[model samples]
Target: YTEDEGFVYLNSIMDLYSRKIIAWTLSKTLEVEEVLKCLETAKRRRKTVNPVVIQSDRGVHYTSQKYKELTKGMIRSYSRKGNPWDNACIESYHAVIKREWLNRFRIKNYYQAYQLVFEYLEGFYNTVRIHSHCEYLSPDSYEKKYILEQTN
Candidate 1:
């Protein structure tokens, strides 16, 4: 989500437990719809039955009334101003994604960036890449293990 000619805004939601990118969207504008889509996608993908708390930066979209309504059932939290530590998990993930993957490619347009991001998230990052925080398991694997453990 750079301001370059070919880049677009990337709104993403991460799960701290598995260090996974649960949901995301790439758009030409930083409209509230972008983050809302990400939030809804995360809930659906996770099959979230209970209220979940979300921690975000003090961005305009996060503070908007529409967003508050959309997340009405859930507890919304904000990171402290000028404190990256308050949102360290997601901030670190963003840095990792840029350094380990996105920086290697030369994106030609927003469409290409979107496709590339989708592939990286779905095909590689979620399924293949192991994370140290998740006991050296990939995010999907970590979640699967939890399910298996519960069923056993």
Candidate 2:
């Protein structure tokens, strides 16, 4: 979220395991409702989801009253101040997203960027992109393998 092009807000929830962008929402403003909607989207998609420990920077959106009220008891929140390493996992994902997808393209508008981001996350990153942590398997494949191993 930046003021580069008339108020852009990018909110995303990422899994640390395979660096998967589980859910995200891009909006024209940093409204609490928009943030809530993104969280709801993540919740709906996950079956047998674990209660998460969400770590983020001390951004206004993450520290807002609405977020605290909405997500109370559902997830434990942690914030980092002036240290990028505190949220290293998601920071790494962000770096990759920007370097590989967002930075390469000329996004004429917010909607176009939104669509491109969504497609990259679902179609490429989660499904096909190999990660070092998973020994070169994509997030989805790594998750499946982990579940299989756990059940066995």
Candidate 3:
């Protein structure tokens, strides 16, 4: 995300099943710490009983020692080389975020970009925007429906 000040990187983790953004962190730089922070936030937010297999592109930030150490007990999966489709969901999401939301605003700084993205994820994307794969339900609705089916 490029603001008037500079480029800001937005790191996010989405729940694969529902296409819901479980956690995110925005920073001015692509430091390994930002990646770790996003993962940690996801872990704390989800607290899923099922084992987690984090699928990420083989970016330097993901390959860093800090990330490896932080994910000590979690499963880490990487997209296959030369096959970006393996992670198409998240990849497509990046485009949608930029196209459908961020591009609409002339973000002045990191704060402005961050606030807009935060609103998009919480107010619109997860709650209002529908996905065809989810039977045209928003991600939050999809997750709730899935949970209901499981419990019943």
Candidate 4:
């Protein structure tokens, strides 16, 4: 939430294998279009030829026709209603970001929120912050190690 924007929504797509946030969009509205944009961004960023499985909460945006159409070929996994643990990985990320970084600032507006998010995600979380799930390597470094292992 921001002082000027009231409440903003962050739509993000995380790669489960690497626990990496492949794409994200911060929007003033909770419209499905914003979620779709995030999905499109993920598609462009990953560019995988293999089938993908996307897991998301059973939100209206994820249930929308546009979202289903966009992810036609991909497998969609929805968490059981009221079961947050099913999507705990991403939920934990949201909580961690707020507790670690966003909660430290007095965000005045959407721009400030976006900037803070960008810095935390791009500068620290993906590049520098270590994760036990990634064998104590940062998300980017973990992914690079995986790619290198695959090639050799």
**Could you tell me how far off, in angstroms, the CA of residue 120 lies in candidate 3 after the best superposition?**
0.7
Provide the lDDT at 28 for model 4.
Answer: 93
Flag clash pairs in model 3.
none
- Candidate 1: pairs in clash: none
Reference-based TM-score of each model: 0.92, 0.84, 0.93, 0.98
- The per-residue C-alpha lDDT of model 1 at residue 123 equals 93
Identify the runs in model 4 with alpha carbons over 4 angstroms from their true place: none
Q: Would you list the C-alpha lDDT of every candidate in the order shown?
A: 0.86, 0.78, 0.89, 0.92
lDDT of 2 by residue, 49-122 (tens): 55766666777767788778766657655655676787777777777888898877777777777888888888
Per residue, candidate 3 scores C-alpha lDDT tens digits across 38-152 of: 9999989987677878899999988888889877778998888889987899889888999999999888998899999999999999999999989999999999998899999
Best by TM-score: 4
Q: How many backbone clashes does candidate 4 have?
A: 0
| Model 3 ranges with Cα > 4 A deviation | 1-3
| CA RMSD of all predictions | 1.8, 2.6, 1.3, 0.7
Query: lDDT score, residue 24, model 1?
Result: 93
Better of 1 and 4 by lDDT: 4
Worst 10 residues of 4 by lDDT: 4-13
Please name the candidate that would achieve the greatest lDDT relative to the true structure.
Answer: 4
For candidate 1, lDDT tens digit of each residue in 1-152? 44356448888898888888999998898899899988889888877777788999999999999899878888999988898787988878777778888888877778778888888888988898999998999999999999899999
Candidate 4 displacement at residue 60 in angstroms: 0.6
Q: Report the Cα lDDT for residue 54, model 4.
A: 92
Q: Among all windows of ten consecutive residues in candidate 3, which has the lowest summed lDDT?
A: 1-10
Tens digits of per-residue lDDT for model 4, 27-74: 998999999999999999998899999999999999999999999999
